[model samples]
Target chain A: MSVRHSMVKGMQNSVGYFISTFLFGIMFGVAAAASGLEQWQGLLMSGMVFSASAQFAALEFWQSPLPLGTIAMSVFLVSTRNILLGMSMTHHFDNHSTGRKILWLFILNDPGVVTAIRLDSGIDKLGYITGYGITLMLSWLISTWVGFNLSNIITIADFGAMDFAGPLMLGIMMVLFSKGSAASPIPWIISGIAALVLHEIGLPAYLILPISVATGIASAMTNRHRSHPPKGETRIKANNND
Target chain B: MTMTTIIMMAGIVYLTRVSGYFIGLQFRHIGELRPILEALPGCAMMAILIPAVRQGDIVDFTSLAVVLGMMWKTNNVVVSSVLGMAILLFGDNVISGS
Candidate 1:
């Protein structure tokens, strides 16, 4: 598929999770309002921070005396997984300028990264990632506005099911990512087991992604002798996606 | 104080989001590490998803199965997510006996 075609597919994938994320943003907006942020402040923060876990954690520290150090640390700790997520995309951004790739990091989110990694091996489809990221960001901001204005519609179903949307989105996208006989499942299994065990053992949340990604990469490297990438997997020209 | 806190928080989060890519680009000489890089998308993906799945109740497990089954049958991303959510919301409520 052409890079443009891939980009369109990615946007469609983002839209698939749009409702869940929008509801999630609305929930965050309601939380922000309850935490003493004004509607504009909530929208502004959502746009800039662009992280659900960080924003939600910040709400817990929304006292008259804001604990800047503690609040920033919590945010940092929560989002540190993005480090691994961004690293995984580095190969996709190889041909782009370093500055451009770094700038692209601004739009990185769970959904965006999942779609962005689907960029064909030889192609630099930065536009695909940007399109996916922007769609999610706008949905988040717009739904924040809705939730801020209509917090009364909080409803009966907003408690737990709303939260599963994130994971469900992840699960659905994983299905998309793993769909084929060509890819090996062993690395995925290893990474998942390692990460889950580490998490259950109470490892710091920030450490999970890096360690798990490292584990998967290590296993894949060791297994490369067993199953190599089919030929033409090298850095081919962008024109030969087929 | 609030504005300062917001900016600081966003800055910290943004740093994590970009740090790995930053390090990767800074030293592109590590051609030997390409397999590790190739392994990352799947590893990182499962790493992110597994914890949530493990923490979930039966509703989540069922919904996951529904999504996977739908994907297997239809090969559609958008519809699978929507249908998954619908099943999750329906199943969650039904399981709760509400």
Candidate 2:
């Protein structure tokens, strides 16, 4: 109870955070360069969007004849997960001024959202988000810049093992999320199933992640209710028990 | 040409971020939904990764093993990742050579 974990603390303490950011950043930069985008293009996209996963996904749509419509659709679909994320943070931002509240809307990425969600209670919410968001943004931009330039000198995939970097980072986060009693595996199972099924049905990759997440949450709610029944529902805590 | 393309891409992503907050604020008072929202990211990761693992080859499985093993042993993402990357690269190279 005494030792509190905030978004700020998570940002400072996690070594994986630094490595994953840089790794993914470089992966994005190199991929962009390989796709025939200039270094400046990579920087602009990374700086403006600040989402490694979506940026990576966007590269798939970077082919010539420029599927602008398709690319926009995919990026939008991929990033729509943020709506769920932003909603999750609304309570924390409800008390802040309008402008201050709006600031986080643009900066919140996946890890930043996770950090914010994990850092509940007895911490400066704004400070935590700022530290987490800004740190990632800078590292992402810098790595993209570096990755683009270095793409010429080094073969990107050989050095970075780019394919393995993202899933590895994700595995690390999945590990973090299961830390408490409430962090049940059932929802994850359900989500995975839903995602696979949707994929098999030919849904785009961008649409799959968020839809599956919703299905997972629904399954989790059902499991929670079944285990405790209505009488014990109030005892389930969001931190670990539910 | 690249500038226009990148800007379009950035705009789309930026809109997602901003739109999410707007949508999130609407649900602030719905206490029952909090857990669902909070848990979505973790579930999303699982959903996202499962297919990849299922579809991958030996190298992918090995990569998964390395990640889980290191994280399980160290209970530290940073240490495990750095170490896991080394194991994956070494193991992958050996397999490729063989």
Per model, how many backbone clashes are there? 0, 4
Q: What TM-score does model 1 score on chain A?
A: 0.61
Docking class for candidate 2: acceptable
The pairs that clash in candidate 1 are none
For each model, chain A TM-score? 0.61, 0.62
- State the lDDT at A238 in candidate 1: 36
Residue A20, model 2: lDDT of 68
Per-model RMSD to reference: 9.4, 7.3
The segments of candidate 1 whose C-alpha lies over 4 angstroms from its true place after superposition are A1-46, A49-140, A143-154, A179-183, A198-211, A225-242, B1-30, B96-98
Residue A226 C-alpha lDDT in model 1: 53
> lDDT, candidate 2, residue A204?
66
lDDT tens digits by residue: candidate 2, A127-214: 5666677777778888898888877764533644445555665676567557632557878878888978987888866577667877
- What local lDDT score does residue A83 receive in model 2, on the 0 to 100 scale? 70
> Model 1: per-residue lDDT, tens digit, A1-242?
55566556667778876776786686676667656688988988999998776676566557787867656654664465576667767667666676876676687877677656665565445657766777888899998999777655544444345455556655654665577324577887899999899989987545776688678767887798556553455435334764
